[model samples]
Target chain A: MAMKERLTKADEAKPWYGELPVESLYTAGIAGEKFFRSIQEKGVFLGSKCHKCNMVYVPPKIYCEQDFEKLEDYVEVADCGSLESFTCVHIGLDGKRLLEPMIVGLINLDGASTSIVHMLGETTVEELCMGMRVCAVFKPKNKREGAITDILYFKPTKQ
Target chain B: MGNRVAIVGAGMTKFVRRAQETGKELCYEAAKMALDSCDMNLDQIDAVALGTAPDTFDGVHMKGEYLSDGAGAFGKPYMRSYVGGGTGVFSVAQGWYHIASGLMDTCLVICEEKMSSYRPHPQGAFLTIFDHTTERPLKPNLLWIFALEMNRYMSTYGLRKEDIALVAVKNKNNALDHPCAQIAKAVTVKDILNSEVLAWPVQRLDVSPVSDGAVALILTNETIARRVTNKPVWIEGVGWSLETSYWTNRDLCYPRYVEEAARMAYKMAGVTCPRQQIHVAEPYDPFDYKELHHMEGLMLCGKGEAPQMTVDGITQRDGELPVCPSGGLLGVGNPIAAAGLMKVAELFWQLRGEAGKRQIARKPKRGVAQAWGDLMQVGTVVVVGI
Candidate 1:
């Protein structure tokens, strides 16, 4: 390898920053629409039962990821669930410290074979434990929207 | 298989958090260096196999088509494969089929990722990787999934954080000798334990850095490999497997997909026992715990045996079964696809006795490189030897 003298004067800097101005809107399919509308209208959780596989999906999908069978029958699930896994996030997406750490958990909702990822609120991260029973805290019936935000967060609940 | 295939040459750019070069420029640099290494020209290449992660990171859709000309694929039979993070070794597999199936005598495989193009943070692009209907509603980040998996793995094995931290300590230290290492440094278990936590059980140090880099490998049939170079590294076997997209349904403690992929590759390579047959190994380590997870997944050791192996210093660069002698994604940078090809390239150097200070003390012959990607759904494995 050969070495060359460094330029005493730096070259002019020319920089360009571009962004992709894009947005996406999705229509919740039959199963998804039923899953969300149930939460919004009834303040209750709904799941799709795949009778062939005997598997229930929380936040239901139209088809079973396992058997590829369409899931048409919807079943009601209890708001309470057991925490399968949890994480306390301290960093924000913008590479900054979050205003406050958030506790996120994967909860296996009652009667569902698959877990749902959601926020854990009304409890301290240090106090969070795997297998802890928690219940969804939903917005008031009059204020509920037909979106995931209808359920404000999950909180520790006494069995 | 139609014809035996081997890697004739490999090249990579320095792994960095950001690069001044564009994605095309990076691809050209790595391709040129790889061609130079084997004293071969683009005209000799019969096909091109390009591997890259999501277009989200590059902020460009159809990343393969956009990057083709710079990869020396102008007017050539070019194909691209995407398996999220597994695209690296998967590209090698794609090229292997090109030569092994007799469709092409010589194939140039290139993997590149320009993660720096994604603003705010490259990880922002990862948010949409979750199911738009269900998982995205919670506003989750990628680290959350890793943490959840790490927690499950640790809880199942009854392992301590200190024991898991050993992977970071070992890999980062080994990277000090790598020419393209990005965050190479000496660290201790105490340092890792004290590092700021990005997610519970996952600290800032546990993760690989966001990187912008490219890696290229020239693969050819046995005849061309023997004719082009005196020390050709034969790709003895290739295997890839994908788990269900329903990540939540599976037990996160073990990566069954990696094990299945390794089993297929090992069977093809005629190796009954991975632990005894494979000499040097490069398991993916995007997070420190992932190294151990993949080690077990690769069947290098029994389930829960990896932590003890780490404690026994068996995973050290000079150990009996040296893992990640290339510094891995953790010590090097994780440009997704590029990071995986870098491991294959490292195996080439190690087998060819050209790894310099990072070479294993024992001149081993056989090696394996594996990568995992996408909602923890896919595993890509490649077996190579001198």
Candidate 2:
């Protein structure tokens, strides 16, 4: 007689558990909303320049982190900056694809002391470097909205 | 402080890959055990602090609310605090504040995680830890970050992979004596080297396995502690600090946040030199290299000196400073939140001379448990002394 085989509960149960509700419209604070709007208008992405330390924050905030004091509005920043760090992702949550084999880089926006996280497009993994200059590519003017996706990605520019 | 706070009771469920009970049920089990150990009931707890890491694990938002009743927080002052893997010790630190501040005489602290609920792979939830715009686009696995840190540590210190593999071997060997250990095995550096590689340098054995479990502690002021138990482990100091979220911009070779937090904790505990003052330590070890990383951060040893101590057996169970005598996250299991609290529980047991076979050879007067979490930059430290 053939030996009997037993199945574990997990083997018998449903493979997938539950799904998280996905939403497109991510709500940001007033300061964050304005930062996104500035990018959509082709104006330099500006942040509050700390008068105390002369530090420039790319995403303008209500208060300075270092001094915990209210920040003053500053001028627009240049589009070009150098890449600080990057990684190439192959897998995603829920076995879904945001973009296959996408390369993401942390680009230090010009005129800002700190770097802003953004996608790196139209660049090969081998071409990426720590201090490579790149410029933000904005969406079409008609399709522009107050969102981070307004600036599609950063691409290497010939300086 | 009006009255000193001490952990009067501690309890935990059996750590496992998957549990038949739900997350709430696991919490209730641990809470019931803690209350039972103290000969007290839910009504005696003045406030409840629940700690769990990442809502992605349980597939529920505001997990504290879902677990409130089971954690004995119904109609009571309740707050949920989280700092990634450091959440468990952070929960205990919050509980200490309630008693020390004279706001509450007794507090029930619960730490639970149900990672098994995430089907197929718990690694799925880790994808969200990256920067949504840039890093997330790369689809990097959580192991990649640890691999990067391990590589940096190795290159800076000129350490070999075998030296780090010994940590996994020792920790797993120690877990054999723990009743709640999830993956306790007696293996060697060869076994670790032979294990499948997840990312470069980080093998399957080098990383902690995902687990589901719960741990709870009942803390009370000195007055209530005397009434509850003859032996109570006093919480001498608590400190926590967070570095910038810009982890990529900072040096990954060492954890400065942990060192800063440890300094604050040791100062309050009146510890002049941690090497001589601390008898045992439970540094967070979600990854094998993390144990060495935190050892330096906690000042148990100077920077770039921990690997030497491990190689010299100075960190062994019988050595000068027995680190992770509870088998740590490496051997025990990595349930994130519960893992940190489990370290505190180990100290409670060790200081009281109740660790059974896993007890250190030397008598312990003071023990420290530290945890690191959140984008490789937050450190939470707790000092408990007899």
Candidate 3:
């Protein structure tokens, strides 16, 4: 029988890397556009609430996770919501260095139970808190045509 | 149950940093090998279950459809499922469900991943896994999350960096006998410490290399299993659970999801105490520290004790619990979905006494394999008995 040989070891330590192309003017799906239009035109966000468990999902989902049942028609949500969690991002995944840091937060939209993830702008990291109330900011009517980008960011509302 | 499901045969392609074969071809190679191992053909399979990780790794959307024909799912009851790196074991669990549920008597379970397809770096795909609007802006690589967890683990247990490096050394050494290993090296603590740092506490050597490969298994019910082989490994129990996607809101030091899943599986398998009853374990180890993280989660040892046990050689092949006898993802290679199934295949071989040089000294009566994925939240567990 031939002698058994062991596997060879790998040499040459190499740095890990990845690349992605950047493009402007992306399109949102029809359903996604409809949801965004409500925010831009009426300052109202919509989501589907599960009748089975009373679990609300913001940025409406087609199906409910609790019962795996299809959701009912759209339910309008209040423009203001509480900040559930937030993070400050400093680096870009595409290896594209960023000039300024960006703040992202999960907002628990009012009248809906679940939090909707979106950009939190024009606020300092210290000013953001879990229970802080904030309202969605929409783009100018002339620039809005029903899209997620219609709400550029959510800013803290003055009580 | 009508019939008990067992994995009768398994096969894997060579794991490599890169492979010229397309993702479909890799699946075909492994599926063909698995079929050949059982002295069976694709036509004999009652169904097919395909498992793969993120679509970003392969640079193809709906990768399951692209891989269907190659996985021998053409015109068959086919379904694709994923739970991040847990996908491979989750695939096998789905196969077990089909056989146990009596929907199909025989199933071909195949898992394939080709991370090299993502140009520049595989790490880029990881950005999409985080909270897109919030976490993505931080520019954190996947390693940062693992590093944060590792730091927490170290602080909680007072463990040293060298203690964790031993896992890399042990797994890599174990890979010496594995034919499919991609970066199997005889590493030392110094070498690991000297390796380039990615995120603090996580070094280059501590992580598994991004690889391309596939692993396949043939699962059949008890009647068919007995007819095929004298010693068949039965899928005694399988369990999987997914935590809320809000990862940062929870503690990262311990994986409660894994503990829940393991408890469910152990209950079904009639295992009262895992540390004494389970002979082998293959917890997901994409990063060196993660192996320890998962070890504690599997309840192999009490919280804050795995790192100490690992340093004492308690996890070696000769130790009481021979963890990662297949060399693990840290040394063998990580193709995401394939790595998880590869651990199951290792347990199958160890239980059968067919592992050759990597075989454990003690007779493995029972084994447990687990995979974790999805922002470090989802956990999938499987327990096999000989």
Per lDDT, the best of the predicted structures is 1
Tens-digit lDDT track of model 3 for B59-176 = 7789999888668886789988888889998998999989998889899999999888876788877877776567766777788888888898888878899999999998998999
Off by over 4 Å in 3: A1-159
Q: Which lDDT values do the candidates have, in the order given?
A: 0.88, 0.86, 0.85
Q: For candidate 2, please provide the TM-score of chain A on its own.
A: 0.81
Q: Of 2 and 3, which scores higher on lDDT? A: 2
Interface RMSD of 2: 16.7
**lDDT tens digits, residues A21-128, model 1?**
333233343566788889999988999888988989887865554433456798999999999999999999999999989999999988999999999999998888
Any runs in candidate 1 off by more than 4 Å, and if so which? A1-159
True contacts kept of each: 0.00, 0.00, 0.00
- Model 2 residue B367 CA deviation in Å: 0.5
Q: For each candidate, what's the DockQ? A: 0.01, 0.01, 0.01
> How well does candidate 3 score on lDDT at residue B201?
92
Per-residue lDDT of model 3, residues A46-118, tens digit only: 8877887787767765445333345656789888989899999988988776788889998988899888889
